[model samples]
Target: MKNISMKNVVMGSVLAIAAVTSLSANATPVCSGTVAGNGASFSAGTNFVKVAFTPKCSANVFLDGEETSPTVFRVGSASLKGKTKFGGSSVGGSVGNMGACTGAGGVCSGTDSAAAMTAASS
Candidate 1:
């Protein structure tokens, strides 16, 4: 996959799982954190990546910027791999051989440096 600059938006409910697939390049995916909720994890393979998250309803966040995938928020899992803001400011995109993905909703893994932002929840 190749990294492609894009501007996308991911909005959905925070009481389940949402998968936002938006990355064409197979590089290391990074993100940040702002709000808190349920459990969220990230995983990357050779062909694709998985973002398993569990929202619990809290606040609204507007990732005013590049967004990949169509924004999937369920209770099981989701994925991204094309071009966008990854997930939010806390979802430390997928990285090498995968990292110790965090399940905390209001936290970042990489360099996304997340702030106390707000997003619309369902």
Candidate 2:
């Protein structure tokens, strides 16, 4: 009886895990297209950058970039100044790490295999 109970518990746990994984996998929506007019704002105190762009897949989307290292910038705002192609699933309105940012006229770029998108500012 104990063996059967343990088997049931293991099976239940596996099924619960699978269900959670499936739900998470399906939560992200696929998005693709060209993005333009990339721009970013940096908050030095928090080490956080916010990037905004016009995406063909949706209206203007803002993505967040958190920097691990301290960032130096003469200006808090930067113009990404170019267009790039993006194809991938969007999580919380961002296509993977598409907007990892740099400051002081630096470029932002990233690629995510799960989202299948690459983004760069020129």
Candidate 3:
């Protein structure tokens, strides 16, 4: 009887662990293209880390073209690849070490060129 009880406990523990691991992977986080812009940033506070994103072109984008970004931001670095969807397209993401953010900039640069090309192509 003791042997059977021990086995049950061990099996329960294993199942619990597997369940937790599965949930962790699925809970990574997700965001829509609500918040898009140049020099946009988010911080997990000191507890997690500070994350920032910069644009290389004219980027003053808004979520759904509204006027703000999403409330929850899931940033990824080169070492920690992430995902993002914007401008009716899904794009990959990358974030670096947590520190003073010197992200990209282009609120009025290549972005203009991109828009022009897009218009011409259309």
lDDT-best of 1 and 2: 1
C-alpha lDDT (0 to 100) for residue 20 of candidate 3: 22
lDDT sort, best first: 1, 2, 3
lDDT of 1 by residue, 1-122 (tens): 13221111122321112234322222222221335343233343232335432234222222222223333211111112212222332233221111112325422223221111112111
For candidate 2, write residues 15-104 as lDDT tens digits: 322222211111222121124332232222332223322212211222222223223111011112212212221122322123323433
RMSD of 2: 20.6
Q: How big is the positional error of residue 114 in model 3, measured in Å on the Cα after superposition?
A: 54
**Deviation (Å) of 115 in candidate 2:** 29
For all candidates in order, the CA lDDT equals: 0.25, 0.23, 0.22
lDDT, residue 107, candidate 1? 29
Tens digits of lDDT, candidate 3, 36-121: 22322333333222332222111122111111122222221110111111121111122112221122432222232223222221
Clashes of 1: 38
Q: Kindly provide the TM-score of model 3 when superposed on the true structure, using C-alpha atoms.
A: 0.19
Q: List the residue pairs that clash in candidate 2.
A: 88-115
Backbone clash total for model 2 is 1
Worst 10 residues of 1 by lDDT: 113-122
Q: Per-residue error at 17 for model 3, in Å?
A: 0.1
